[model samples]
Target: MSTTISRLLVANRGEIAARIIRTCRTLGIETVAVYSDADRDAAFVQLADVSVAIGGEAPADSYLRSDVIVAAATQAGADAVHPGYGFLSENAEFAQSVIDAGLVFVGPRPQTIAAMGSKIEAKRLMADAGVPVLPSAELDGLDDAAVQAAIDGVGYPAMIKASAGGGGRGMRIVSDPSDVLEAVAGARREADAAFGDGTLFAERYVAPSRYVEVQIFGDHDGNVVHFHERECSLQRRHQKVIEEAPSPSLDPTTRTALHEAAVRAGSALGYVNAGTVEFLLAPAVGAGSPEFFFLEVNTRLQVEHPVTEAILGVDLVALQLAVASGGALPDQAAIGAPRGHAIEARLYAEDPAAGFRPSIGELRSFAIGGPAHAAVRVDSGLAGGGVVSRHYDPMVAKVIAHAGSRDGAARQLAGALRQATIDGLVTNRALLVRTLQHPEFLDGRADSAFFERNDPAALGAPLVDGPDVAWYAAAAALAVQAYRRSTDRHTAGVSSGFRTVPTGPQRIALVDPAGHEHRVSYRF
Candidate 1:
């Protein structure tokens, strides 16, 4: 039954919504965009064929309102809905609501989502399917002594994780026995607040490990295939920052084993559409083979999906739409070996030196220039004069580069980022450039603890400092004066800085991204 989706509604906002609209255009599907008050005039909203205001500014009032989103889809006459990687994407109830409304949901079935939504249940399911998983115990209704006993059984340095959600929320790392009960209670409260489910579980925490995941896709025909792996070891606050394909740290044997394990896991769940099987890889030690453990399965597309698409040379969103329409999966042989290496850096509007605090303001300038060869790609929803709202995630863009070699890709990406014209908001662009060019990262020795070992303030320091600031400030002041002179009605024919009487050099004070002030004095 190959039913076509003539019209599709994107139930999210920002760059991901724009990304989905692009694919829908390519597939000849009419697109509808649903937005909140904050995104009423956003780029994604303008890009869609039709736009609808779902509710107010907050996520709960807009993007997370499944009923409103479904109503908008019906009102817009859209046949399907695409939850683009964020709010309500993994909510099984939301998915069921879409299905119940006689609309196609562009993701896995509700049952599969529910099964994998809980980390405890997902691990049990993986273990039963013969997938390697870390030792863990469920702590939903356990007493104080039982909880401590479970933590002791899982060993020291155990991680208490929220069973119902991801994104590093409701998680605590416990090393001391005295902190077990407190950590558990706090995690429970956070989980309840974040996901409305306080159920939790304990698992052994792995340190100095590489975070790798396999991109898997399944179709309605019960076929699943792996699109190799991505190395996402570089992180902050348990969130991925930089990701690359064909992990530089994995040996050939380990890579093959990981792909097979991911395929097995997906098959066990009968997973459909795009999903990622994440794993924690412990590097080989003294002639021993590297060991990998199934971390969890993200039952929806991941944020770092662009790196996989670049290496595989496929549009995952297109494939997702195709499968959602009851199409068959592409043959494994057709989706051949990876062509080259690709790396993606998340350019976020945050001050890394200031504890990664989100920075919000108008994007006075936002341009990313790359080589003429066109190996670089930037996926962003912002442009010059756009506002970065405080109501949503502060990620400004994702910059990706592909090259014949890993080093080439890193260097090319670094050059592109270094020469970018991003202004106004404080961002982690400098830190991304530093990580790409750092010796340890190039040698593939960097792990999830990379930030812990290297201070972000040092890594995110401005590329130019000292006297360069004075020169930049002087140039800015000159430009401002020139513009004023051009627009001034009183100084019709006068040149900039023209004065009838002798005077001291005009001074101007400016502030830099790091909150430092510089004074500039220039005569002409």
Candidate 2:
């Protein structure tokens, strides 16, 4: 039952929407972009062959409105819908709605999504499929005593997680028995607010572990293959900050075992399309092999898919479209081995000095400098004169670098980030550059707690400081004075900065990215 998608609708925004459009253009598929009020003039909207206004700025009124999105697709004459990564990508009901509307849903079967959507149920299914999983207990509708008992069963230092969602929401780690009830109540409220489902579960917490995941793809013809693994240990609050392929931490045996486990997990679910099987690898003690436990499965393409694509020389979104159209999986041998090392750093609009608070404003100037080569790539949704609204995720771009070795990739990525010119909003670019060059990160020992062990203030400190700041401020003041003089018609003959009566030196104040104020005084 193969059907061609002549016109496809992208049900997402930002860099991902732009990324999908690139693939569609190469494949000669016409694209329809759905936008909110905030994204009416976005890059993706301008790139699409057709555009539709869905709703307001908020996600509830826009991207998450499944009915509205499906109707937009129908109205735009789109035959397929690609839900990029976030919002309703993993929502089974949304997938069903796309299917019911007689449009292709470029993802897994609705049953598979429903089965793996719940952490509790997914863990049970994985355990049944012989994949290693941590001990966990369901806490929905349980009394305080029962909740405590469940926590005791899962052991101390348990994590209370929202069963219905991911992205670090509705998650709280409790080490003390006294905090169990409060943690549960708070997690429930947060989960209800975020996902409309307060169902929760508790799992044993593992510290000093590596966060690794396997990229798997399946087709309708009952075949599943892995694109190796990615190390995502560099994180903040469980959100991935930097990701690299062919984890430097794993030996051959562990790596093979992880890939096999991932394939088995996907096969068990009869999965179709692109998905990731995440795992936590515990540190080995003495001569024993390190043990890996299944985390959760993401039912859509990951944000870090570029790193995988870089190393494998493949297009995951293209493959996703092919599989969605009833195509068969490529031969396992044809997929081949990873060619080189690739690392991706997420560039976000946040003030690292202010505890990573989201920054919003017009992007007065935004440019990421690097050779437009396959070795170094930047996927972004914004440019000069664009607005970073407060209604959406603050990720501005993903900068990726590929080289023959890990050190080479890291150095290249760091250099590219250093050359980027981003103004008008605070970002984590400094922190990303510092982390890429950090000794522990370079040696591949940095874990999920890398930020906890290192001082972010020190890492995120501006590269320019001390006497150098004063020199730059002086230059800027001079440039401003020159510009004003050149533009002022009445002062053309005043000889610039001239005063009939001598007075104090002219003063100008400027603020640096770190919020430090510099006062420059000069006289002509």
Candidate 3:
């Protein structure tokens, strides 16, 4: 409450930055955007009232440079800083810097970020606060003897997670004791690359696990409320592909218990603004019956916030602004009433069938055709034809569907995806549609193993261009030949374009991704 916060600085890029910008504009708050050299002309930059060029192309020189961001905020005369997901959002040091600079950090307190930024520290804090935690122990002198002793106790399937890493980095699953050392070394190297810390810990690799996370909000007035859970089961690597509100597997009693746990955890931290409590749920495991154990706290808005917004009709970004500015949380009984079902599909410009390799190119054409009802909404940061660069994440847009039931919402999302078209860049849109329509998915039986169990090529349309179009092109070529050849003796080389009834043969070569050519030959 010490600062008035009339102006705010968005300290990230892409769709999330634009998302927060929209909310700020609605609140009559002036917005300032910080951009790297590459993102100087990004949509979020244009949408902001003002923009600052912080550094060069690299994230470290730009987005991750806390000092640069703080200086930019100071120069822009912004009263608050909103680190929209990723980058420096979870860095407690960055939060502290913003505070020292006399600007409100529109997120959890610095202490909360520090406590949760490190997975080891967060686990210990949760255990100390009586939150349900998984079976795990920190590794300190992880030599051969130590590894053997710990692995024997933790069992065959264990996870080696980075003490100071997240977002899918620095984590490896060891199904056999023999692979522990190698996996641990790889995890340590990845952790060093990401967090400058190579330290790791061992934890029971929860089986049949679902990434269930709770949305919670707190204010300076000490009031906190839970907005239900999201089931992020369908993920590639550790990136979430599909997310739904109110996890399908949870019963009424379990849902209440989970919410209570989240509230208690948040109250324990004196958390403020918007945050998510992630849990590793090994449903039907002994000791815990389809229950969730505390994983970590994301002390900022999550990328999948729209699902919660759709189900609860709450604008979390706005809530963050209000809470950061000393406003009290809304009446819990009235605000926590979640209705309807919401589903979100992240339409990334990646080729899932191609080892999920990142595809970067110009979007020749992009259009999303969906139901014109209020229940359907498509949030995007790109125009019809924007360039997708390797410099950033491949996500172009998020398509969300809201309905009265899970099946309805899911079907709505599939139909919307089917009508979408993008010409140039390779995307997993078709794959998403296939996943949504898969029999197992429709029946709510999809798990993390679903993709591996199914055929990748069959997961989407076989060709980048629809099967019908390819066949249509071929049929059109055949028809042209059929019309000219009266005897119907036309072959690949003896095409309809043989104006003088050619005596020789001609071949047309078409190259494919595998560097092979298919030659169509005909003789006239």
The TM-score, computed over Cα atoms with residue i paired to residue i, of candidate 3 is 0.89
Order of models, best lDDT first: 2, 1, 3
150 Cα displacement, candidate 2 (Å): 1.1
lDDT against the true structure, per candidate, is: 0.91, 0.91, 0.82
Top-lDDT structure, candidate number: 2
* Candidate 1 wrong stretches, greater than 4 Å: 370-373, 486-494
Could you give candidate 3's per-residue lDDT for residues 1-524 as a string of tens digits? 54567999999988898899999999999999999988876778899999999988878889999999999999999999999988999899999999999899999999999888788888888888788998887776768779767876887689889988587899999998878888888998999998999888888887667778999999887888888899888887888999999788677777888888888889999888899998876666575558678888888898889999999988889888888989888776877567999999999988766787888878877777645534577777676657776778888898889899888998889887777867677788888988888888888777766777876546754344545545544544464457546666536465455646466564455444434444455554
Q: Write the per-residue lDDT of candidate 2 for residues 115-202, one digit (tens) a residue.
A: 8899999999999999999989999989999999999999989999999988899999999999999999999999999889999999
Error at 163, model 2, angstroms: 0.3
Better of 1 and 2 by TM-score: 1
Q: Please give the lDDT score at residue 263 for candidate 3.
A: 88
Highest TM-score model number = 1
lDDT of 2 at 56: 99
Ranking by TM-score: 1, 2, 3
Clashes by residue pair, model 2:
none
After superposition, candidate 2 runs with Cα above 4 Å error: 370-374, 482-506, 522-524
